[model samples]
Target: MIPSVILLEKGASTIHADVGEILFHEDSMALFYYQVLNGRVRLSNFLSDGREVLHNVICANEGFGEVAILDNGLNTVTAIADSSCTLLKISSKKFFEIMHEYGHLHHVISQKIARELHFKLFMIKLIYNRSPEEILSNLIHKLNESKRLVCQECNRLMLTRQQLANMTGLRVETIIRTMKQMEKDDKLNIVRGKVFVPADGID
Candidate 1:
């Protein structure tokens, strides 16, 4: 990920967003490269049926909206703040200029795009004919492996049941029920409504 200092040096500006604030809309022009300085951001879209499809959760120190900028196309997903967030943003033109000046940035961005594509492909394969428990387990495992868990120490899952449902294409009720069963099976622990995976991961 690009450092804050570099972004600032290149004229990136700081922006604060409250929870539920929309950073950008799907199908809108991509004009800036944004990096989360604090808190979480959700990248998602709505289906024809009005159901939400979660794309990715942008956490601190991570960047989003680059793919649209790189392709010079509209954003594929809408970005909203999941919590009060501080972000650094640079104009797309300036971002491109910086990329050109820093040849290694191309490699970094390529790896990021490739990793995201791999996850999407994996999820597509996983959701086909997979049980809710299987789907949730694998998704959490993958996120953990990627160091995307909100709390690394206790392995607490930061995503809400609704968010989990959005990601897995399952109903929120199904997520709640399956997660409770998972806790019963000792695959995870639900402490005060929060989910915590064991250090060694699900059984």
Candidate 2:
């Protein structure tokens, strides 16, 4: 949905961030509400002692930093560029101005909230599961069913290696090794930037 330019008084700005670049730090003054124009954004958390832990990855066409615009005057998590990326941003003040002008914007926000809650539930299930592969399988199915380009064989997203790590809650090194083994065994073609799930055989 194109945000009505009339209601939002923000001056449009674009930003490009390199791999692993910190876009915004936690507790930073809420200035801009961003949309991923290219690449991905990783929302991460830090422990009291400053350990960087990945919370989740925001993919293409997603919106972030809306919560602060809705309630708090500050942000909750640090957003970092998952890789070299581009973002289109609108200032927080302008973000809320449009929110107030168009009540329907809340509906869009609700949808995002729903997806986040669903992801959280899936994570909880993974935490309690006895088998990590089973957990990964379940996540693969969830994302595949949600309507992105899924490899027909493994049902994994046609995303980059790092993306697989973010989606399946595994390390990139581990996923790469596993993918290679799967490919060697004729499971499916696992390219670095895509997972080609074949039409059949992995029943």
Of the candidates shown, which would achieve the greatest lDDT relative to the real structure?
1
Could you tell me the TM-score of candidate 1?
0.97
The per-residue C-alpha lDDT of model 2 at residue 16 equals 88
TM-score of each: 0.97, 0.74
Instruction: Tell me the spans in candidate 2 whose CA falls farther than 4 Å from its real position.
Output: 1-9, 47-52, 148-188, 192-194, 198-203
Number of clashes in model 2?
2
Local distance difference test, per candidate? 0.92, 0.69
The Cα RMSD in angstroms, rounded to one decimal, for candidate 1 relative to the true structure is: 1.0
lDDT of candidate 1 over 1-203, digit per residue (tens): 99788899999999999999999999999999999999999999999999999989999999999999999999999999999999999999999988989899899999999999999999999889459999999988998888885478878998999999999899899999999999889999999999998889875
